[model samples]
Each structure stands twice: as C-alpha cells, then as structure tokens.
Target: MEISEIQHLAALARIRLTDEEAGAFAAECDSILAYVAQVKEISTGGSAAPSAGAHKNVLREDVETTEPEAYAEALLAAAPDRDGRYLRVKKILGETP
Candidate 1:
C-alpha cells in the first residue's frame, strides 16, 4: 500500500494518522500483504477438507441461566468511561429530560 492509499483509508475510517505515521503504517501493511501473497503461492498438495481434522465446536445446550463475566466486561469496555455497573458515556440530551 502506498502512503496516499493509507491516507485515503484513514479518511474513510474517520481516523487521523499523521503523514509520517501513514507512510510507516503503509510500509508495514505492504509487508503483511506480501507475506499473505507468499502464503497464497504455496500449494495445498493434499487436502481432503479445507480445515481437515480441525477441532469441532461441540456446542452444548444452554443448561444454565447465567451470564458470563466476559459479557459484562465487553459492555464496560465499550463505555468511554465507566464506574461500577454504570456506562459513563457522553450525555446525549439536555436538562429537558
């Protein structure tokens, strides 16, 4: 990816990357892309299935009515700021509420 391409992507993503940062990130992205291209060049000599013998997701029924800790953590993580169980996001309305 070129520096200009990086800038265009940053604009589309609503992110602000400095000129130097954009150039550096573009080089890094290009390196990663090249690595993926190399992987694509490799031949899949023998493959019965795409993900053969891969671990199957043996899902079980919802046996218990309990929430996972990660679920609460994820919600709190999304808050701009948080205290206890409260999501301290920016106020959306005026005192009229």
Candidate 2:
C-alpha cells in the first residue's frame, strides 16, 4: 500500500494520523497483503477433501426428551399472581382494568 492510500483510508475511518504514522501503516499493510496472497495461493492449490480419521459431525443428534408443556404446572405453582391457569402481570401500557 502507498502512503497516499493509507492516508485516504485513515480519512475514511475519521482517524487522524501523522505523516510518520501513515508511512509506517503503508509498510505494515504491504507485508500483511503479501501474507494473504500466499495463503490464497496455497489454499487454491490443494484438494478439497478432509483427511481420514477426522470426525465428520462433532455434535450429537438433536432429540426432545420431554413433552413441551411438562414444566407448565411447576411454573404456574411458582408464579406470584395467577388468574386460573394464566399468569397475571401488571398492565404497563394503555388503559387498565
């Protein structure tokens, strides 16, 4: 990267950088960009298959162990206020009964 390009990027990011800082960033960016290019070349040159003995699925199969409403009675028993089977919370908006 050139110093002018680095200065433009700093301006776009709303960052204030001195001439010395911009020069330093330009050199750093050049090295980083070269490393990325090398990585891209190596990745593109290889086969897309995984090596043997590697675990294909690291996660267990998803399974439901209980009925969906199994906890309803326990939750209703713990409520501070309830209207029959439903919880009764405070009315925070609009007109209240």
Candidate 3:
C-alpha cells in the first residue's frame, strides 16, 4: 500500500494522520494484504477444504416435556401485582385516557 492511499483512507475514515504515521500504516497495510494473498493462494490450491455438505445444522426435535399451565399458580403467586390469575404490569408505550 502507498502512503498516498493510506492518507486517502484516513481521510475517508475522518482521521488525521502525520506523514510518518501514514508511511507506517502503509507498511502495515502492505503486510496484511500480503498475508491475505498467501491465505487465498493456500485455500484455492489445496484440497484441504471441506465439502459442500460437510456442515449441517444439528437440531433436536422441538417437543414439550411438561403439561401446559402447570406452573401458572406458582407464577401468579410470585407476581408483585395480579388481577386474579393474570399479572398486572404498568403500561409503558401509550398515553392514558
């Protein structure tokens, strides 16, 4: 990477850099790009890559293990405020009439 390119990038990112900093960043960017090129070469030239179907989503069957509303009484009892079997919470989004 050139120092000019680094300076342009810094300008785009709303950053101010000295000439010394730009030169340092240019060297660092060149090193990173070289490393990425090497990785791309290795990935493309080698057969060590996994096959298309090598990965699959492993999920268990979604099924209920307990009866519905089994803990309703316990949950309502723990509520700070309740209307019979239902919990009463403060209205948060709308204006009051």
Candidate 1, run of 10 with poorest lDDT: 45-54
Per-prediction TM-score, please?
Answer: 0.51, 0.41, 0.41
Candidate 2 residue-wise lDDT, 1-97, digit = tens: 8888999999999999998999999999999898878856665545676566755757766887789879888999999999879999998798857
Output the better candidate (1/2) by lDDT: 2
- The alpha-carbon RMSD values of the candidates against the true structure, listed in the order shown, are 6.2, 12.7, 11.8
List the candidate 3 regions with Cα displacement exceeding 4 Å.
Answer: 42-97
lDDT of 3 by residue, 25-93 (tens): 999889889887875655465456667687877897899767998987898899899999878999879
* lDDT head-to-head 1 vs 3, winner: 3
Instruction: Give the Cα lDDT of each candidate.
Output: 0.85, 0.87, 0.86
Q: What is the lDDT of residue 10 in candidate 1?
A: 99
- Candidate 1's displacement at residue 43, Å, is 2.3
